[model samples]
Target: MSTENGTIGSQGEVNGDVMLTHFRKKDDDDANGEVETEETQVYIENYKDKLLIYGINDSPPIHVTIICALQQGLLSLSGQLIVSLLVAEAVCASKNDAFKARLLSSTLFMSGITTFCMNIFGIRLPLFQGAASEYVIPLLLMADTDQTFCTSEPSKEGGQSPVPATTTMSPNFTNSSLGNYTNNDEITMDRIIYNVQMIQGSLVLAGFVHALLGFTGLIGVMLRFVGPLTIVPTLTLIFIFIVGPVIKFVEVNWGIAFSTIAVAVILFLYLAKYNMPVPVWTPSLGFRIIRYPLHQVFAILISIVLNWLLCGVLTYAGLLTDDKKNIGYNARTDARIQIVRDNPWLTFPYPGQFGPFGFSGAAFISCMIATLISVLDSIGDYYACARVCRVPAPPKHAVNRGIMIEGLCSMLSGAVGCGHATSTYGGNIGAIGVTKVASRHVFIATGVIYILFGIFGKFSALFISIPYPVLGGAIVVMFGIFFGVVISNLEVTNMSSPRNIAIFGLSIFIGLAVPTWAKKHKSPVQTGHAMFDKIMSMLVGNPNLVGTIIACFLDNTVPGTAEERGIAAWQVSEEDERADVDRTEFNEGYEVYDPLIPRSIMYSKLMKYIPFLPYKRGNVEKELGNVKTS
Candidate 1:
């Protein structure tokens, strides 16, 4: 055991010295002031402190970091593959199989590059960047619109076809329209290219808007208005929105879905507390024993493998039929097996591969809202990652840089024609919490792995073919926990206060209410202008965006004390004059610009006021000193 500052840490000495129980924060205790019985000491002493490993840039053993990175990278890739599949299913249903595979590859490629850039230059945390779920709604909207547009055209009857038709014949001299019958390959390519171009346009526009916000540091100003009330409903509504899609997929094969949920719950929750003793062979220390939480580390991966095995077994026994004609059986089978065969073994993502970019004002407007949603989601993730990593909450500049990188990479996503934007992956934050390994180097390695794996089209297709039921089952657990994490932030607020209660209840109600209403009445927000109407409709339809905007407005304007609204604890600012010094000293996750570089520019007398740079020592000290005296 050891003590650092005021915090206590202990290694697990579980077998003999179990009396040295796991330490819990006072806040974790019940009214009786007793710790939970499930937690106990294991092997390492001061495990939390020792597990700190390398603080951001402090180099650890190459092998160790590599292992950690590979694990995290693979998990991140798996999650993105699922997301890519979802996006493709929604937007590319009428396009060629190869086109969908290309979209998946492009998303993977862009995600890897974006993650690497952000880790190196942005927030520099261990957060994994991938396809944002918030953008899925907009993509689906575009797909639906495209479908309707095609159907409305008199020339194209039966607008929905998975694959284009092929026919070969000599042009009949008697028929003038015979010349217009193009080959199936050209028709398929044209449809795929057109869709990609439109999505690319929206992504580019949204990225530019987000980058501008981050660059001007305008997003930081908005953060002050966001309190726990704003976060809780917004986050919960996000999960609620996500659950609709999961239910749609899972409902296809309830038996497979239920089985998946059962296995996942057993592995992730039931076996979470059980640790297995394993022998560790260290070169210098010889063979020693350690108790490891193998279940926590491999819960998702194991659950998936178990479900896959069950699927295979059931199919072989004829209990679960494998029929392309049946949606239920298709949900459980590797129905996308053709994607692997169609795409090359190895292919790199090239910008404009789908053809020239095309712009749509309505699509751009929808994407703008999605970008705003991503911004809000990323902010919550920033705080979550910091908390799990045992670091102080991010200051304004760090948050700004993170968003800036997100925007910049979003542009790259468009350039690569991924048809979706990139943002921090909530799944990876969960992974860090489970493994308790918060090394930025590991994420850096993960980024490299993503880039490498993305080049292999077959690998992307392999994961893409994972049963939809399995994916839905994982989403149930993941989104459920996501909702819980957001709600848990309420602990800082005075939940019993009627004023707080009203705000929370109203925010959630409006969030759910608006989306439900918008869906039932499509043109609810119609202004004569089509683009403006589309934008408002999209915003109203998204529960997270609506709830967040309403909650932020109420929390900032409503008559309530800072304590009642949870702002005081949620945004814990120090009155110390060394605020600038504290940021420099505490940021172990990623190196912000060197202290010397900012100091060199400080002679201009206006550098500290800038949004991208770190706080100015002189100005911060002056303001903080005045506050201290007051």
Candidate 2:
């Protein structure tokens, strides 16, 4: 092993099974060339002062594992449900309670499947995968521009369209004759189904492209040009552009919405350090009190539950309005109660469950753009997760495998008609930092729990029945966190430089301006070809896409050194030829990310030649020698 002092063992002495531990004497050597070994405690210098309850590779007791898993599962589930609800609203499915419930169930199921696969075979990090808000931006844009769904103008005050009355007609009607149409509900259902099918097809195509990028090692090449400057504006605009949707939900009942936001803000910020004493039982210690950060760990969930109860009580007391046309009517707890009764007890989402898939060039482009952003965000998430887990940064091969798996999961999501892609949950990573539990076993168990909950249709129905105001409150806090996190990327760049400031300012300004102008002036891009015009208009109108393209163009072309542009720190070397001692020492933390397979097969000669494998041919020989010697 090697440390700051020096290497402590010969090459043959390195043992793969040995846990990483190092010690140093407090006092220096005396004048006689002998060490002055003072009486001192031998502490693990790698994690010294961190006091982590569980490390990346450590497996806790079964009970502890289940409890931690539940916490993570709930946090991820909340985010996924919110994204599903937003997609439902965008696609004009808000009035169809059964369809909304099905959408929620599908999203949850896919998230569980993806999260499960990610932990075992993907990056092997303690990160949760869920429905991403990034894709929602494009979905919203697509819905707004669709001729079938844009027959009526949305309300100018709240940006919400009136919810159509429920109908009894089946959504799977195949009659294409206009004479078969009985009411507007039939047309609305057909449009929603068609749009969902289009999304599924585009997601499948986009996912294939995404997987190719990873499997071919193109993602690493693309990262060479990406820096904080490009990421900051792209991600910032993602959250900022979603304000219209959040406002639509929040305006349902400002009183409840603001209350929810206030509770979340207070719990997450003010009461974060405060701990609650909880009783615990163990085989050795019968009963014990443990200090848990309950508020910090469950800030979002608690706020939703508290406000939901409040809305329920107010509804029972006849305080909330029941009038369909009145404001704040959606805040009532019974607003979507019918969904709970309509949903089945169990739902197993399968491919082509919705209908025959449909393809669209415009939708494909939008999904591809969103997929690129998801890739960039996930790369950053990997580094952040590694730092929080106190492990070495993930190697390039591990990252490629992670991206490949993510793309496959998105394909699965599309097949099931979830209308969104899956990405790493940043909130769960933040929970790891607060709870100090980064065990992969815990996350794996959490994935199983997610699968169980996803199959229980009633559970998903209950979350879908959450009041719009409460959801709005949660969205405000959730997206607010998302915006702040991405904006913090600015810390890595030379913010003091006028060049950077000018680039950021111009990109954001044009990003917002172009989209607003396009929205006001329909058919702004008047190319002779209708399809080409629509695609070009969609690309230019999206704030995130515009800002990303502008920022990337400026950052790459502008004259600046790598260090000044933060590229030096942002980019990790593809290969590091460290000395044998240093390589063994670093592997202690990195081995946690290795694939769940026999080392004999993983480091075999044939496997070493594969670009996506974690080990190289040269390292295989050295690793085999160490194994044989040990």
For candidate 1, the 10 contiguous residues with the lowest summed lDDT are 168-177
Q: How does candidate 2 fare on TM-score?
A: 0.78
TM-score, per-candidate, Cα-based:
0.77, 0.78
What is the lDDT of every predicted structure here?
Answer: 0.66, 0.72
Off by more than 4 A, model 2: 1-53, 60-68, 71-82, 85-94, 146-192, 249-275, 290-295, 324-327, 387-392, 433-436, 574-588, 605-609, 616-630
What is candidate 1's CA lDDT for residue 326? Answer: 75
- Residue 55, model 1: lDDT of 51
What's the lDDT for residue 212 in model 1? 79
The parts of candidate 1 lying over 4 Å away from their true place are: 1-95, 142-148, 151-188, 252-274, 316-318, 330-334, 525-536, 570-610, 616-630
Model 1 backbone overlap count? 8
Query: For residue 255, what is the lDDT in candidate 1?
Result: 76
Superpose all Cα atoms of candidate 1 onto the true structure and report the RMSD in Å to 1 decimal. 10.4
